[model samples]
Target: MAEIKVEKKKPIWPWIIAGLIVLVILYFLFANGDDDEMIDETEQEQVIDTTSIEEENTANWDNNRNDTVGGVDGYLSYIGDESRMGIDHEYTNNAIIYLMNAVQAKANELNVNIDADIEEIRQKAEKITQDPMATNHADKIKDAGSDLTNVIENLQEEQFPDLSQDVQEVKSAVQDIDGSVLTLEQKDKVNKFFDEAGDVLNKMS
Candidate 1:
């Protein structure tokens, strides 16, 4: 019979040390990894927040400029309906609103970005009505601008003479505005409109 030898049990210290080492490695692997992930998550959130703010600012700027252009064009049409053809208030108001919106849409289509100040234009438009003594003058000035714009709208290069006198009158009145409500950009538009209208009117004449 082979003699069975009793094997001595190794000290528990080695096993305990091996287990502690495994735990420490796991803590660094998972716990420290999670901390790194948290930092990445924080960075991603900050980038998203900043993007949202920039988008909001751009939207606000677009809306403001759109409103400003619309208001100015509306005022122009309103006085035109009243002065040129004796259009009633309700029709004039509604038509002016539509025309103004149309102009804004066209500007957008052409990518003619303008940074018009809506509040400032509104204030000036309101002031046009406030001076009782000069109300008619203000109204006439607006009418002249609108008439010129209309003439340009209808111009066909072949018809310019019929509106020659009106074109001259519009130019004179446009120049007389104390400071002018239209922006420099708008003034440029006005000038182009006048040139086109004059060419048409001269041909017609």
Candidate 2:
């Protein structure tokens, strides 16, 4: 009998085919994943853009309206109801002037007596600037400072005299309110001033 002849089949070709198929599948999966990541990034960017647009729209809307302002009393001296010299209302202007004068007098007395008390008054006044009802009065209070400063300057120039005793008394009353200290007598005075100031403010509108 002739020796049996045998041949070994090559396995390399099958392995190469399987590797190529696996690489192709990996490539497709990686490419699809990259596309999904890009889509997510774009969505996030669009959301940020939409939020910015809404904020800008809200700001524009706010800018168009004449909103009621508070804490403008300091600058009230610079503008008037009719845009004339100082405030236009006679009663309101005079009452504010009176209040300012009183504050100045009290401030002077307290300055020599207890500077700490004056500081306390200032702190209280600053706090009042935050109140909803008091914000509108801030301008008036600030303007009062200007008015009193002007008077003091005039006195320094010898064009004005020192505040009178009545003015001093009035100032003491206001200082009590400004310092959040109220005696029975001071309380009565403060109530009167409040009533008068309310009338003046009501007339402004």
Q: What TM-score would every model get versus the actual structure? A: 0.32, 0.29
Give one digit per residue, the lDDT tens place, for model 2 in 18-119. Answer: 999999999999999999999999999999999987676455324322222221242233223322212222333333433333333433433423234333
RMSD of each: 15.0, 15.5
| Number of the top TM-score candidate | 1
Q: Residue by residue across 1-205, what tens digits does model 1's lDDT show?
A: 9999999997999999999999999999999899999999999999999998767645533444445354334444443433332222222223323333443444344454322522233223333323334424334335534543443333322234456566555455455443334222143433343333334333332
Task: Tell me how many clashing residue pairs each candidate has.
Answer: 11, 8
* Alpha carbon lDDT of each predicted model: 0.44, 0.41
| lDDT (Cα, 0-100) at 110 in candidate 2 | 33
What lDDT does candidate 2 reach at residue 56?
64
